[model samples]
Target: MNRRKQKKLTNRLVWAAAVGDTCTVRTVLRTGVDPELPEADGTTALYAASVHGAASTVRALLRAGALPNTESRGITDGTPLCGAAAWGHVATVRELLTHGADPNLREDGGAGSTPLFWARNGASGPHPETEAALVAAGATD
Candidate 1:
């Protein structure tokens, strides 16, 4: 693929994950598109799926070799676990944890917050299941 086509495909892949389009995600990957391509914001499709609570898509992406702990540096610079926890997606958090995402890995900037911090203080407030999962995974406050 040319650069423009590659970029567009990457955008589509990211969008598919963000919108919870698991079938489209599979189609895009089946067409030889890599699941780990980073968007402009440094987010992989896996990160987007995790953030949006797309649990099945998260599993599919991970099965396709998406790195569970890939971090990005944007306004929200954190790993997939951070995004999932921030949104109170307990199932997604479990999926990511099962795939080896590190709940204790802190965000890159600001207070160096971990997924535990986001689970406790994100816009959704503290989610008990998410918090429990993080705690079970050895996350710190």
Candidate 2:
């Protein structure tokens, strides 16, 4: 895999995950692209999938060895769990937690908010289900 080819595959994987294209994600994974590969600004495929609430894509990435706690920088600044929680995506949050996302992990790009903080103050409104899931996963304020 040359650097250019690897970058192209990684871009495809990231775009596929962002759009919830689970099939594409799996196909790219099979091609041996690193599941943890980040985009130019440091957004991993798992983080992109999680932010979109793409649970199926999230699962595919996780199964392909994406780290659930990996953080995104620049535009989408946070861990995958933080991104999911901030968007009030309970299923995504659960998927991340189940795959070893540290519920207590903080987003360095913000005020270092945890997943719990995002769930409570989420722009989508306070998501009780998301909050509950985070709490169950041992997330603290």
Candidate 3:
């Protein structure tokens, strides 16, 4: 694929992931675009999908080999697991954990918040379900 076409598909993949548009996401993936492709600031499709609680999109990206634990910057800043936990997306958290997200991985920037920490101290409020999912996945402190 040409650089121009590849860039367009990558943008589409990121947008689709962010909006939970699993159908579009799958189509982009089929075009041989690496699901791990990051946007200008380093947000991968999986990170975008996870931050938006797009569990189905997350699954599609992961199935295409998106790394569950990659640290990202840009619209959001952290691992996909941290993004999901911080938002209290229980199903998204579970999907990431099931796909090998390290429950203990810490955010690179910020105060090194782990998924459990984010779940317990989310700005939206404490997320017991999210916390529970992290704990069940072996998260600590």
Candidate 4:
């Protein structure tokens, strides 16, 4: 495939993963598509997987060289860790942390909030697993 076609395929795969379409994700990966392609908003396949709580997809993307800390998709201030934490995906958060995602990275656009802050504020109550994951990943306050 040419460069343009390859880019298109990559974008489709990223979108599919972001929407939690695991079947499509698997197929796309099997076709040797790049897993780190970022969407127009700067959201990568990893970010999409994290946002949709697709642990398997996230793992596949990570294994395929997707950077856990990549802040593409115009969300330079937000990390995959933050997305997982904010959405209460404990497993995803842990996976991201284990892959070197920084939990204390401040949000983009001067939000001045870390993943832990977003996790706590967005949570309904005390979530021990999420809290523990964030803390273990070095998130503060």
Decoy 2 TM-score against native = 0.95
Which sections of candidate 3 miss by over 4 Å?
A: 109-111
For candidate 2, the lDDT comes to 0.89
TM-score of each: 0.92, 0.95, 0.94, 0.82
Tell me how far the alpha carbon of residue 54 in candidate 1 is from the true structure, in angstroms, after superposition.
0.4
Task: Point to the candidate with the largest TM-score.
Answer: 2
User: Model 1, range 34-141, lDDT digits (tens) per residue?
Assistant: 788887777789888989999999999999888898876664467888899999999999999999988788877545788998898876788888999899988876
lDDT of each: 0.86, 0.89, 0.89, 0.75
Clashes of 3: 0
Q: Model 2, 27-74: lDDT tens per residue?
A: 999999999989877889998998899999999899889988778887
For each of the candidates, the C-alpha root-mean-square deviation to the true structure, in angstroms, is: 1.7, 1.4, 1.4, 2.6
In model 3, pairs of residues that clash are none
Alpha-carbon deviation at 29 in model 1, angstroms: 0.6
lDDT of 4 by residue, 51-128 (tens): 768887887788778888776547533667777777788998888888777777776633566778767875455456
Residue runs of model 1 more than 4 Å from their true location after superposition:
109-111
Deviating ranges (above 4 Å) for candidate 4: 75-77, 109-111, 123-128
lDDT tens string, model 3, 57-117? 9998899999998888775679999998888999999999999999998997645889998
The local lDDT score (0 to 100) that residue 58 gets in candidate 3 is 91
TM-score of 1: 0.92
